[model samples]
Structure formats: C-alpha cells, structure tokens
Target: MLVALREWSYSRILLVAAFLSIAGCAAQLAPPYDKTVADGLNSANTEAMTLMAATSQGTDKNSFSAREDTYNALIGTLDALALSAGARPMPKNRFTDAINKVLEKRGGKPIDDDDSTPPSAHSIKKIAETLTKMRDTDKKQGVTAIEAQAFKGQLVIYFDQAITYENFLQR
Candidate 1:
C-alpha cells in the first residue's frame, strides 16, 4: 500500500507540471518590444527638443521657412514611428472584451475602445499633429516665445508617454 501511494503522488506531480508548462505558452496581450522603435523614439525626441530650444531662443528668428526642412524631417520620423508601432500585432482578449462590453451595457465605464491602435502609436501621431500645427503657425506669423515654450512642453509630455509605453512592453 505504501509503494502504490508513492506512485500515485508522483504521477499527480507530473500531471501538474505538464499543465503548468502548457499554461506558460499562453499569448501575450501586448506586442513584443522592438529595439528599433525605441531607438527611433529616443533619437526623435532628442532632435525635437533641440529644435524646440532653437525656436524658443529665436535662433532662426522663429522663421518657419528657415526651419521648414527640419520640421518636415521630424514630422516624417514621428509618422514613421507611429506606423511601425501600429504594424505590430497585439493579441486579442476575447474574454476581457466580452466583460468590458457587458460592463458598458450595465453603465460601467468602458475600459477600452474598438480601435486596435496601440497607445504608443496614438501618442506618436499626436506629436506629429502638434508639430504640423506649429509649423503652420510659424509659417503664418512665426512662433512666439510663449507659443514655442507651450509647444515644447506639449511635445515633451507626448514623447515621455510614448517612450514609457514602449519601455513597458520590453518587460
């Protein structure tokens, strides 16, 4: 009877181990980190800060024409980064989605929207839009020191959020 009990306990342990191994292969909700994307974000953020500093200091006399190429390049970089982020595959959570929908129907705050775009992508896109608007404003009447400062602050916030989100995905 003692030998039979030992065998049964060992078998139970093996079964639990196998089950855990299978569970460990479950899907990840967020996409895997892309070093290229992170590098791009860092580089772009540096460039953006430099450009904004120059603008605020009136280095180019706040002339959009003087820095048109720079603005275009920065905007292009941000747009590319956004596209790269959006291209990554994010896993679906059907159970969570169903629960969120039910909660929403019951008047609970919605956890998320139907849009599949990642937060990093959305944040990057917002930065691009802000840059475009700044470019347009400079073209019209040149960016005032106050306006430049405000835009710089906004860009910093956006960049921080995007970079943080990308770093989170690394873990």
Candidate 2:
C-alpha cells in the first residue's frame, strides 16, 4: 500500500509539473519586447547603411555582396520589430498603403512586381550612389541630424507603445 501511495504521489507531481511547463512555454512563445531587440534592430539599420555607403565608393564585389546581405537582414529585422510592436498584419491593400507612405516620403518610385528577382550588383551600386547623394544633401541642408534624431525617437516611442499593447493583450 505504501508503494502504491508513493507512486500515486509521484504521478500527481509529474502531472502538475507538466501543466506548469506548458503554461510557461505559452507565455514565452509570446514574450514582450525587451530592450535588447529594439536596440539590435536600430544598430542593424545603421550598419546596413554604413555598408551600403562603403560599397558605393568602390568596385569591390565582396563589399557589394555584404551590403546587399546587410540590407536584406535589416528588412527582416524591421519586419520582426513591426510584429513585436503589435502592428497587425494588414490586408494586402492596407499593406500596400503603408509601404506607399514610406516610398512617397523618400521620393521613391514604386515597383510593380510579384516576387521579382533580387536587385543585381549594378542596381545595388546605383542605389548606393543615390543614398550617398541623399546623405550629402542632408548634411548640406542640416537635415541629417534632425531627421536621424527624429526617426530614432519615433521608433522608440512606437516600440514602447507596442509593448504596452502586448502587455494589455497578455492580461
């Protein structure tokens, strides 16, 4: 009888532990946005821009490849940041509208493609040139400092708000 009782107690303990483990995993699956992730994304964006600038100045194939890879990584990081910020995946039209807003702000023309090939080295070089020119203009007009600070502040606020929303949802 004592052995049976011991077995029963052990089984109950195991059951309770399993339940708690499952709950813990569920919580972690949707954990809140910590400072590390936010900072990492910001750093990645800066690094990508720097690489792009370097690639534009020379004909080094390796630099261009690195710049392209960094740019793609930045895009992924931005998307993840948006997700963590609680920006719901909008419908196709809404997503297009959001993208258009950025494009318009940058005076960029929209491309009409559904899974187009990635930009070639030549195209990347051209983009880098354009970015260099824009950077120069920003410096000349004293806009770079203002814009960079404003963007950083805006991103921080946006992420903070997102964390608030996530907290609310968790509750």
Best by lDDT: 1
Q: What is the C-alpha RMSD of each candidate to the true structure, in Å?
A: 4.0, 15.5
- For each candidate, the alpha-carbon lDDT, in order, equals 0.86, 0.45
Q: Give the per-residue lDDT digits (tens) of candidate 1, residues 64-171.
A: 677999999999999999999889866668744666578788986755654476788989999999999988888877777888999999999999999999988888
Q: Which stretches of model 1 miss by more than 4 angstroms?
A: 6-24, 57-62, 95-108
TM agreement with the true structure for every prediction: 0.79, 0.27
For candidate 1, list the clashing residue pairs, or say none.
none
Model 2, span 39-157: residue lDDT tens: 65456446655643443333333234434555455555555554443332223444446665787778777555432211121222333343444344443442344454443444345
